[model samples]
Target chain A: MPAKQTLTFPYSRRPALGRRRFLQGSAAVVAGLAAANCRQNLAGPPAGSGGSDGTLHIYTWANYTDDSLAAAFTELTGIPVVVDIFDSNEVMLTRLQAGGGDAYSIIYPSDYMVSEMIDLDLLTELDQSRITGLDNLKAQWQNPAYDPNNAHSVPFCWGTTGLLFNREATPGAPADWDFLWENQDELSRRITMLDDMRETLGATLKSLGYSYNSSDPEEIQAAYNRLLELRPHIAAFKTTGFENELLGGDLSVSMAYSSDAIALTLEDDRMEYIIPASGASLWTDTLAIPATAPNVDAAYQWINFMLDPEIASAAVERLFFATANQAAFDQLPADIQNNEDLYPSEAVLANSEGIVAVDTASTDLFDQLWTKVTSA
Target chain B: MTPAPSPPRPWADRFATRRWLGPVVLLGPAGVWLLLLLVLPTLLILEISLVPGLRLGQPSGGYGLGNYLQILQPVYLRVIGRSLAFAVGSTVLCLLMGFPVAYWLALMSPQRWRNLLLVGFILPLWTSSLLRAYAWAAILRPSGVLNTMLTTLGLPAQNWLNTPTAVFIGLTYSFLPYMVLILYASLEKLDTRLLEAAADLGATPSQGFWQVTVPQTLPGIAAGCLLVFISTLGDFVVPTLLGGASSMNISRLIYNQFLGPTRAWGFGSALSMVLILAVSLAIALLLRYGDKSSVSET
Candidate 1:
């Protein structure tokens, strides 16, 4: 019989090649691309893109930027600007903290996040001498409590969080937080609170006749208990997921930020938003340069560009967000000025408070209570 | 029957001394891989579990059992329990649906079409899992594809998305193919002569199936169950999207603890350890039972 042979042992070495080597090489290439992409994002605007100094990158909310505004800025100042949108203050803060946002010359952080960022030393103090049109802002925002004297941040936009509901779904528009509590029986599985802890918990605190920035542990616990009481009726704790349901008529009410509610109300007549009778958290999103910002000159220019009344007014009309620039507000169309959602009545304004970061003890208490509420 | 003829002397001489090297060479890379990615990360999580209240970017104070103790809190326990319920429910659901299809594919399907049917079953897995979850959302929502179809069929519309039932459905749908694939692999090797012999011995069709076919496929069933169970237990997406308000499973809680307002890395690490332990126990049970079933089948 002819000798029969079988391949055996170490498979003859065969140059030790495998498909995995190709995968490793491909992975290295992908990782290199990702790092370069991240670097471009973190190192400031791309080369030769803006005003001969490169485009200014402004990290902001989705509704804050419009194409025409960017196009106009490019035509006027020659400094092309790019906007990156984030859904929440915390997510933006996380990106900044993780060194992912060093490229941005400007970032929009809400009032309390501004305070937190300042404490963390992430923001650069503005050179007031170079900044133009500082006096064009609304009086309240001129020296806001969150960034007093405007030392670190410029109040770019201001709005209040409130209840947005489908008026056709229920008999009347939701007027207050207590309406949810009183009608928990009827509203079971039909409502959603913001996924945000501070906004949701703070609203609950305000509903129970407490301050939005209450530092008292007892008040925090009371708010926790109140939220627990309402959890059975709550369909979900969501920030952006409620939009589809609310628009589809499956959700009757959702706690929403004013910018989002205003846009939605404009889309449908049946949808309306109201500041609760007891009050809600008013938020001011501010533009500030990070300390690690690579292009300080570009940051200043971006700020001055936003402060321009024509630009700000056009943004307000296109974006549907209320602006902190008083000069711009004056230029807005009469219909926009009269829009109640953008500018609520004084009685509603009186009850609103800007969210502020409480002391560590209170924050801890809030965390504990949030856990219990969600777990239950 | 005569034992299979031994290999010729020259071939036997070559392999007899080198058989050990074959397994070692073939398995070394994967073993190293398992150690680095799986075993090392698990150990790191175990170490982190010992530190209490350890937030990321903060200096670690010391090592203790405080983080593990926190898991005993009623709130956290409820989350863990809910996770188990979802995983177990989905595993059973997948098994119930997967087994019959695997049986038909392996034992009954035409030989030429068998591979094609399997490719079809596996095609859904090629797309991103996130896209699948979103597709389920569109289909399961109140005014969604499923409800629209139901209304057209004169059936009542179902509101299943963002509910526990939705979570179960999503998980079962996501993992059913893996169960079927594993069972089919085991079942294709089944001996048909034994089944025919049982039937010839005056055994009824039902008895022949139970006594012959089932015993032959026990190993496949065990393997399929374990694969489905382990995958469902570690899943993070379905429970987050489909599990509406208050579906605070251990995985989501751990995520929130790290990334959300709390930023308690210690508690998150502790929860990670618990999840790792639960998955390990399931794997251990599978190895034992699955090995026994395979041996009995042989």
Candidate 2:
């Protein structure tokens, strides 16, 4: 499951072996990239990112699609699927807008990003007529707030943002966000959190009984202050690389996405993931075709292929993300169906709020306060 | 001065076009590469920097100093100060540590083994720099090898990972080879006659080294320091990987603007231009005061 850690390291292999030759090659590549970036279309996404040749290019989070899934899709559609990964929704958005995602026929954007892309006209209105098994999606996602009636996105997988803690190393099992603030002395320099701006700050915001998508300047500033207090105790704010530390007892706890956290918990019985009492951010990763996507036919086929209950169940079992398809959920093994980390109860999820596309001013404030939080 | 005509020959006839052609052929590809990659991109950044508050996916605003002036804010100034401190602190550490090894390698080590010994010193360079930083993380983390060794030796464990100290260690480790290589080059050509002469003039060993060896290696020192300074100033990996929440240097700050939650390209470009200017200034100083001899002394 480490293969699906969101921020997987890039393949840094160089043709040259010696450091000197590698440095020279890297410098050239950097310069060549700078030269290439000079010519950009900043207004909107390109007309067609290399309209589909025979292959379906999937721009998605790491671990979302494995060889089995791609091979299965290829076998069914007779068109091959190639997968590329991005750690952040914003990064995926930037890649699409920067004209670099031309070859991609599908992208897996998270809940808020789905609507943001729709607003930017970067997403194609998904053809419901061609897609199958839409009715199998859970009632909550049948008409999700981010994309009403699944106009431009299909809810593929969903999860919560919470703490993955080592029960023995930690002072006590943390049940909520306030545990860190309360045990600052005991946990000093022994805790880590997601490096994500929204998730980190949103968690802080939720700890204060405010909205995760707080638009008020004062609330955001308060969250910054609260985070600053905990800053000294945090070993690092990392998205993916804290696993080793947590396992080694260096980091007692880390705020992680449920997908990654569940894998770690399953790896070791001592490790446990818990959603804060206040609530956690609920995120749903959706499959959508870009407005500039080529090979619309292949894209639809890929979506329908994922929608199949058997395939979704297999993917959920293998990749470890909670499936949004009710049919797929029923197909999971009884133990997996009841794994709290994978799928917390409705009562636990009652307070969870899906991060939505906030207004521009609020977004700016979030970015500004986030910059202050990090740089300070 | 231009009127002397030699006997006509095919080689001489070709010289007419060859005069400009030689320079064009020699420098053309390099010039185009620089113009397209370095100069053009820099100019593009400069243009973007002049605009105020340009958001990604949004239209650029009219020309203003909003972005550059924003750097003067206390928050950003602190970031710049930290970056400068890291670069300067790492440069000093590299020189203090590298000089002694370089001196021994160049002047004291046996001639047959000097090259092999230097190669051994720089063997860490064979690995990718990202790998090197990660190795340091493994060694320096609280529950890492260093802590285990310390506890075993009845010493207090040090938690250095994800701190400014960790950043210093990472940067120094990354650039020490280059520093030693450059200093070794300059120190290799030390005029022993001058040192011998200093000794004859009733000077002690320290006095002789200060007066003779120091003066001779000053250019090398300047070159090494500036090279390390420029590289560390803009380095993104070490500080981000090892430097924790508080380690927001200029490179990371600029990265945040362009790629982080906020797509403030105007501000990112502005920050970028400032960094480029700083690096370019360091390079100008390097060319002006650095060793005129070869940098690839290895």
Candidate 3:
């Protein structure tokens, strides 16, 4: 099993050499990549695991794993943990596909990415008996579309993308996605949507009464056109750069993830987060073992460790993520439990849709349309 | 000749076989470096680019020119064109802004303060380019420093951020120092005697500058422009930060293809190849035309 999981380094063969020479060449390539800052932090686990030979490497979002969490796991199970952080699901998947995921046993990818990973046969099926806290997950998460019945991934956190605005700058509150369109005159060059192609286009699609994952060419093009109409009003397509402008009152509105918006809103009362009336893309970040994972036993142990309700609760509170574990949510402080941004009421969530993988042709069209929109 | 060689052929013939050693030693390391890093990667990219829509883990399909063909689409071509415009515009702007300052520093400024002036010009560059771009945002935004100053002066404030002009300004500002440094190096070597000769021959100062000084600094100008152009062509940060929602360029497009949702490594590689080719062409032109003295006068 571990043999199958070993990365097929892109440059595995050499015309001048045999198998041993090939391994050395590949090793050198990995070393060179590490030197170039491509995948250095991915090696989170210390060498000589258990003071011996087993190491469980986890690739996850930044701030997902801390030293205390690693120490706790090490102390509890005598199996050490090494965590490497990635900024985005796409980046994590890209590295995994590029064959840099050999040492990593566990990875965290967002909901849609989990579907893509499953399609690519990158994930290992989890044994339900081995996981202790499956029952503790909310009913909706247990049967999530991304990973039905928790077949391959464990849902860690879920959130929606919506508006993050400055209350002081905008005399009145922004109530929905249409608010930006309505105020395009005033908000011109003072509003930024997300940098994500799917989310930004999806938001436009949702506003126009289309599915976030619409495969229809007409619908996708319509979304693109709508975005182009608002192009002059948009300040920038930024991922994380809107913080200062929003705070400084230079920006009136920005589309943001609930996690980021919630974090920022907590810092200042003048900032407000709103889940649009129509809807937005709902995303979940999840953890799964890769099919190519070495040390299966360590991987199982790590999963079980994360499944403990107390540990899950701690992660939810400390990490500031919306917990999928119902038991953990019950344990959270009242203020956090009632945080509307994290756990919006069902009426608000009804309009939301999960982004799914589109067909190949549709995916290409989306890329082409996105290029046209941005480059226009 | 054979008769003469017959006397001491043993050690001489054996030792003479060592002459090829120097070239091999001199070029070996760099040859291997280029082969592994540059040549091999480019070949790999070519192979990947041939397989249209090839994601990393998926089995690669039969090869074709699909990826290259995709770039020919008007949308992508526009992106490439915009990137070229930005690069070329920035190069011209840098030359315009830098030449005068370089001229002053190298020719007119007091000798004792020359080094200090050059250091001051480069001080902002010593920090991260990202920081500088951010600083420009603060100064150029609608409610930013420039606008506030304009309003205070009862002048119409300019809405500059998130515009093409902002991108050009940022690119020019970011690359101006590199242009200045290169021009200064070339200009410092100016022949003052030649200028005096032209002036003595009844040429006015302007004519002297055009005839004597300008030609001398032509090489430096060419070198500076090429450097600025090549650097700006590859710059994603400044344009992405300063250019509004619609301002996608080749670098950002390439970035989206690679790291963005599409993950189309093939298309991304094709774009990369084009950028590399463009920069290579500019450098070739620079090498072909740049002269040591001609870089000083302007």
Candidate 4:
């Protein structure tokens, strides 16, 4: 008899979050487009009128904030912190652009988004003199490609994208991205890919021995065709909802971010995470102050609070984020320090690539191809 | 009175001409509201729909039919077709399931219990539709409650979740209460005297139901169906949550264009316009048929 389990995941309790994220994002964009003439008004007063309010308003990912973290900061400094969460980088950017996010003093953007925000002049340049623990970041992030010398953003957590599977249910260990296509029959209607267009399409590109950010039209077309072959066997394209299904044996496998997948692995022993042999995308979540921030001092204080080794280690233990700070890594337990999924070996590091914004033509091509894939 | 009429009252006489002020004051707030929030925004969407390849934060190009023409693509056309199928299928299902329950309650059920039963039917609507859709997900999954019961009964388990079947079930469940409410209103006013008169003339129950009952309630049917169809057509929640992969409907498609990794506002606006046009057409049908049926009944 098959073991039956309840379909309950922590995030599933708040099902409206996902739907609301999409709605608000789409609504903001529509409103923005309609009022394009008022774009200049959204720039949010000149940047120089920065003063510390009693509360520090932060805009970050959903799982990053907890009561204890905020309490710790408030205890250390007199300033209270009010946290708001966003589900995706695109949603955050859209909200910010629409001037709905002017109240936020700090924001958490991923690696690629840092560069995009820089291009859009949405970020404020960091003053090195104010921050204390810049030297604690791992060497890889010290002069990262997205923001050289940590000029505008501070690395908070870094991880890679990979496949999370139920070890007992899957036929065999998925050593690479090709495992999905190879076992499509046995895994029929029991697998889910990321809802993200870039991540899903990039995995296919890697499976075909091409770059994750391939701009070549022929290569892109080839990758699109390969994905179409596996589309029918796939159950859904979802970012967060797949966890409960996978846990209850309804889904055998899912593509997930390391932070989310790690939380589940800690809960259920049967789950396993593996980076594909060919390649996967490396991502880093960073803390930065938006240019329109009203409290620059509080924003710097929050970043420094996050960078402190003790606070970073505590966050890692409680939240399961892989910290980018070297000193924080030393403070972790041996088992966590040795966890390959969190800190993979150099060979695995060499195989991964960071996603970047492509040219306009390529972007349009990608949008067109993605529409075809989903519609088909 | 002729003497009091005095000299010719000017055309600008305050009290005589000011009679129009009462209506203007009454309708002013709603008229301004409709213009600012509804008409202006729709006009804005129409303007954006005319610009091709328009991305937010980027300079827009000259107006053209390029964005509208993109909808002619087979991929988008397929999405539109699937949306129509979901709407029409759920409307028919709601009519089938809701009519009998409504008829029993409106005409045959105990009068004291009528309100309670109707409230019970509508209780699900009080919760968030998002939560209801999630509940359906749990019930319809492979190892869910429905499949477990089926297996215990020695019946074949149906794999209905994440398929078009799930979409239909969810849509029908969401809109059935509205269908019942409208039909009950129409059926409550049902003339029982006509049925008695027909029976005395030797007309059978089935004949009376077909000839008298249906024609009298035809307007209600049209109104109920139009409401369900329009709501289902624009429903992004059910299809996004339950329809799973390969279930690309027009609302989700429009969402994707606007916020799903690609910011194609122009294309998204065009899709929105198409959706608006489809709904307008449904309302047109409702006005033409629904009014005529009621008029004939009167």
Candidate 5:
């Protein structure tokens, strides 16, 4: 969900901002290439001018903001905003951890990363009293798994990790995660999983009747071995770059986020996004202020700006992500509300697990196995 | 690098007494820039490499060789081995393909069109390397332009994208121009008289090329190969874009450590040091052989 941005061109297109920028070995250099286009979009006064000088710097996924969104916020608040995009939550977190994120007054991290930031004390505690429209949030987001009671982060966009396949290209419609393994011969070198480690590994874990956040070494090892079997058949691990191939029927299937997949299916009739019958990982990208945020006042204003139901609904209409704000959802057109992929049913939601920060040992295990899997 | 001797003047003679002053005045800005940007950052990475199990956003601990030692693990060794293989393979491919075109452009082709031909050869470099790799991706995918063309010609289609074969093609394509430019520079100065001299001495064309042409251009060949080797060795775009899952070389490995799921800065720094060392080793060889070959020829 953190990587829901279509603008990510993968260099797997820009880390989808970290890949080609590693020469410096510092997180600062990992600024997404999207910043080149984003620079011109920055409006009003110079950023980091301090003291509510009508400047707000936001670091977020590319899908979240458009020029109009920035213009709208500035029109209402009179604060010109600068938007910088990050492809992955890890890249976002790394930049902040490396002290390169002080300029950003606001950042959008995915659900699991919200919890991670909270644990690290990197995020400021949200001021519930100052924020209006807090009650408009859906019941689930009110006390979400990643950030309990929405204490530190605001739920912005939500989606699930699932297979997006070409109906004509695949031998059969994939009903679940196990479909790929079962149909390896037909799907060989034609399937692209997410470049994301957790989503792919977690999906595999769920297929084997294990939790998406399985921490047990044995369960993880089993998942690794299973992934190894499917790896040869896997064409590439990509988040943003597979769209053209999949649409062209060169790729049979791709593991993708609902936001990206939903957009594709809307344009191309051949593409279909499905949640695995076994289960899938549910992800929520959120808005949070870094503890070291320079402009607290403008940050609050921006959060409140997004919280407004009218603004929120408009974002959903244009951006195509499911609205977390119930007021916004109620205001959305009937067609959008009825879109099953955008808003999946309750039973499907119940089966899905939110990824969490696993213990260090488990993380190390995942990294080791992932390295070996890719290398071998 | 030698500084020019200044015209002796009354005011300048005082400062000129300090002989080291001339070099400092000449190299001061660039030297300071290199020290700050390159040398210092590399040393910092070196220091971080010595700290075992150092994760980002964590406090530093006592340093050890654990990170470097961890790189000795077979999994990492295979990655290093893969990177080396890609580098060596690309260098050879470039040399094989570049030498001929360079020979023609430098010596055999129409003299007036030589510069234009060289420009045309290097035109691909003007576009972003990322864009070039992406273009290759578009061309090499299963149903991409390459296969389309092959099928049109009544040839078997190839699905080289996302394979090691694709990586080699992409790397060779990206680096070939550099090889050509350097080889051309060397081949341009090929004293035709030497070839004539060899021919007059009962050497066949092949013998003349092997004995005189190659030896004369040995320095450029070494320099170009080293340049290609270094560039391909550190390349992140081609391998990541075209190499697919198996192309986890040292650069990608370092990328994964720093920006990937694991923020193992320590291990990433270790990998960086190793890559740096490998490139430095290439440069060292270039210095050793690039100069020595020219010297031996002269």
Candidate 6:
């Protein structure tokens, strides 16, 4: 019967290969050029070479920027803010290290990245006297582990890595990271984990009652094995593209960032976001001035503008990001302020840990394990 | 043609002295472009690939073959194998689907509408390939168009979107137009008289097609197949978007090493060199064998 099914669709056997041969032939050349182009861009000069005197270039996440934000900043200050977005911190760091990030005065790097950058001496130590609203940050962010005393970076927004699921499709509400492992059969080929190595592998480590930043080889190997067992059930290692599938009921669950999850939950009530009961990785994105910043004065102004309570509160409402500013949180509507997913209870918070940069040797171990997991 | 040698031109004769100028001027821009952008960059990648465990912005530990040796691992080998399988699979699939459409358009279709039909076949290529891959995601998902159509026809719905099958479908769909275009070009110049001659010799239509048509368009078939094979091998978008969990081909692997958390430029470069070598080999085969086949056919 299976053989009959295979024969019924020619594609089932391995579809005919010659039809689009020529198109792909040229596209292959383009892909090669693109790869080369990526390498060049990585190795190129820093971003501010365009020779715009009035423009303040900012490299940040895609979700952090909007036309209104840029326009309002430009309106308040005469300098126009040019925004460039990066999908991951590693990519941004690599570009910067390669010499392609010099054009931007302002950059948004996550907590661990800020620390890494500071250690590398790539960030400017801010003179707090020049900047206002440093005290307005939430108590936790007042002196973050990544950047104590707000020396190098200012907190932009914070969130947790967790599971987002459609209540109707999932067998039950996934309370913890173990839910995925326990219900592997039910969620088969219908779940997506984050593409980030630290987040996904860290989640597995946490499920086994180890630290999110575990460095022990045995613990790492155990986490890798646990993930390998659940590998067959995962549809893909995706971060952004799973939204449509999750909403359409095609996906039972997806591992997501709190910001992305909260945005989706707002759209559809059935989509529920949860910080796994055992624990999750807490993350904070921060705005920092790179050492090679061209317009330092304008960069300071941009930071001050973001630090303002009215602007920060308005941005959170419009963009669906949790604000790092305590003053900003106070100004938000009652319902948004009370949302537990965005601002989880203290006990839940205590359970979570921020993902810091692991030592070089451990990073290698993680990379090796990740390659094995994906390839397998 | 061996005329008496002309007297050596004097340096004073500007025109004769500068005889090499025209060719130099004409080819210089493109030659320089290929040298700088293509040749130089490839050489740099070769250099980087030799550095063992070279991460961008990190101190390099001199040159070694460690990066290339790393590729010998079974895990990495599997990625290369999967990439080859996709390339070869898609090549054969494209050839099978493209030949018939090319045949109709080239020979049987109305002569007046031939160009229009060819244009229509290539219409999908105008849109971004990334957009096209996303469209396939929409059409192949569980609640998507394919399943809806299948259920309507009382056929079983397929769960293919995040599987190897979807990768094949996306790849074949993406590359089919190029196959048809190339095949049509080959088949259009085919001699109809040979088919008639085979028939006159009491050969049946199928036999005639096998003996005459197939042999005549052998170069086109080879060219089309090689083109598809080479392209599909390095394809990143189709496999990443549609191949789901099992879609870790060499291109994506290379991407991960370079831009992903690993930042292992040495390994990435080594992988890239392998991809470049594979593409160059395919092109060489097309140039050598494809030309020979056409020459023999004529």
> What TM-scores result for chain A when each predicted structure is judged separately against the true chain A?
0.84, 0.87, 0.84, 0.87, 0.87, 0.89
Candidate 4 docking DockQ: 0.34
lDDT of 3: 0.79
Instruction: Supply DockQ values for each candidate.
Output: 0.13, 0.29, 0.27, 0.34, 0.32, 0.28
| Candidate 5, DockQ score (0 to 1) | 0.32
What are the C-alpha RMSDs, in order, of all predicted structures?
Answer: 13.7, 6.4, 10.6, 5.0, 7.0, 6.9
Winning candidate number (TM-score): 6
**DockQ, cand. 2:** 0.29
Order the candidate numbers by DockQ, best to worst.
Answer: 4, 5, 2, 6, 3, 1
Candidate 4 stretches with Cα past 4 Å from truth are A5-53, B1-20, B291-298
Query: What are the TM-scores, per candidate, against the unseen true structure?
Result: 0.83, 0.91, 0.87, 0.91, 0.90, 0.92
How badly does each model clash, as a count of residue pairs? Answer: 3, 2, 16, 0, 5, 24
Give the CAPRI class of candidate 2.
Answer: acceptable
State the lDDT at B126 in candidate 2: 95
> Which lDDT tens digits does candidate 6 get at residues A1-376?
0121221212222222222322333343344335434666554334555235768888887667778899999998878877866667887787787776567788999999998899888899998888899889999899999888989999989999999999978999999999999999989998999888899999999999999899999999999999999999999997666776776677989999998888778877788999998889999999999887778888899899999999999998877788899999999999999999898888887789999988988988998898778876
> What would the per-residue lDDT of candidate 5 be over residues B1-298, giving only the tens digit for each residue?
8999977697667766667688888899999988886888788889989998787666767899988888899988999999999999999999999999999999989989888999999999899887788788888887777776677689997878889899999999999988898888888778999999999999999999999999989888998898899999998888888988867888888877776776788888999999989999988998887734432332
**A42-115 per-residue lDDT for model 2 (tens digits):** 21234453353577778777668878899998888889777766667876787677676565888899999888
What TM-score should be assigned to candidate 1? 0.83
lDDT of 4 by residue, B235-267 (tens): 887887788896889988887776567768789
- Scored by DockQ, the top model is 4
Model 1, B1-298: lDDT tens digits are: 9899976798778787689788889999999988886788678778878988675445778999998888898888888888888888988998899988988999899999998999999999999676688678767776676776677689997878778889999999999988888778777788988888888888998998788888877867887787788888777777767776757787778766655666676787798888878988988888877734443443
